[model samples]
Target: MLHTIKQYFNRKGLRDPEYEFLFEPYTGEEAVSFDCETTGLDVHHDEIISIGAVRIRGNQILTSEKLELFFNPQQEMRVESIKIHHLLTCDLVDGVPLEEGIRQFLNFIGNRPLVGYYLEFDVAMVNRVLKPMLGITLPNRQIEVSGLYYDKKIAAIPQGNVDLRFDSIMHDLDLPPFAKHDALGDAIMTAMMYVKLQHIKYLEKF
Candidate 1:
């Protein structure tokens, strides 16, 4: 089945040879939940200052083995952005360069499916740097925690509308709120959310 999907993507020009390994059969035994703190929200222009990820296996989050990296951005730090992540300019001066940081990140994540809250933005930020060095963006599968929560909430009570805010979902699910806006903190929070969402009463499939 995975081979067929890879063949289809290759024929359609969506598969990059460099990323072929990501299309191999997935055991579904584990996934990585990741988050990034960027210079700004603009995926095309902003740079990632920090990245954090933890592994999830069989409903257990492995906090011991993880990746947390910080990078120096080419662009000057914006005051508004600093307030959010608190990664000051001085703090990033000793940080790793973009290519090296991302290289380590990719190595750490391997081919595991990625999970997070509003995850595409983080993926885009990483890809912006990756395409240049690797000739391909991350080809791994992605899962969004918020989308899962929304699906479960709606299915439980079809007409019931739930606040999708990070804090709101954490509150409703009885998950402890972590420090907001920091990459590692957010990654940990999303990991916990993913575990809880897995147990929610739902449709036939996860």
Candidate 2:
């Protein structure tokens, strides 16, 4: 009921008529797992330097059809942030404008639900522009990999503390070593976590 109310305002606030498709009903079962590499963690001030996402149809991750975009930042990036994403400003010279990148992302994602490790922050970062440009936040459903993992853990250990750390979850799941640490790499890995968790849920029913 709360989501319906919020989505009502989101649709009523539409500033761009062309994006009306975003509000359309989605019958497809596919979802997109995405990640954003920003200049910093501060969504209020930091900028998204790059975005990456992959489509998931059923239990399979369709890596061949993926979206990877880089945005050229007008300002310099901090040293601490560089250590995190390893993306230097010089490497973004070929990137598209930030708005263009966001537009492409919206088109690529369409009405599909979003999946991610820490999705709220990434959505907030994108909404920084989306609200001003289109007067709407992403209306797509969100599936958090960590939240899913937490549900599984808490079911097993209701009183025990659950480690929601990315590395910890990856280790517990026995997933493969994914060393790229880039936006796309993280998205792909998070997709694996989502699919594995879904499988675990199915297996638990028996």
Q: Top model by TM-score, which number? A: 2
Error of 1 at 112 (Å): 0.7
Candidate 1, residues 67-158: lDDT per residue as tens digits? 88998888987778888887887888889888888878877787899999999899988878776676666778889999999888888677
Model 1, global lDDT? 0.82
Estimate TM-scores for all models.
0.87, 0.95
**What residue pairs are clashing in model 1?**
none
- TM-score quality measure for candidate 1: 0.87
In candidate 2, the residue pairs with backbone N, CA or C atoms under 3 Å apart (3 or more residues apart, or in different chains) clash, namely none
Query: What are the root-mean-square deviations of the candidates from the true structure over C-alphas?
Result: 4.0, 2.5
**What's the CA RMSD of model 2 in angstroms?**
2.5
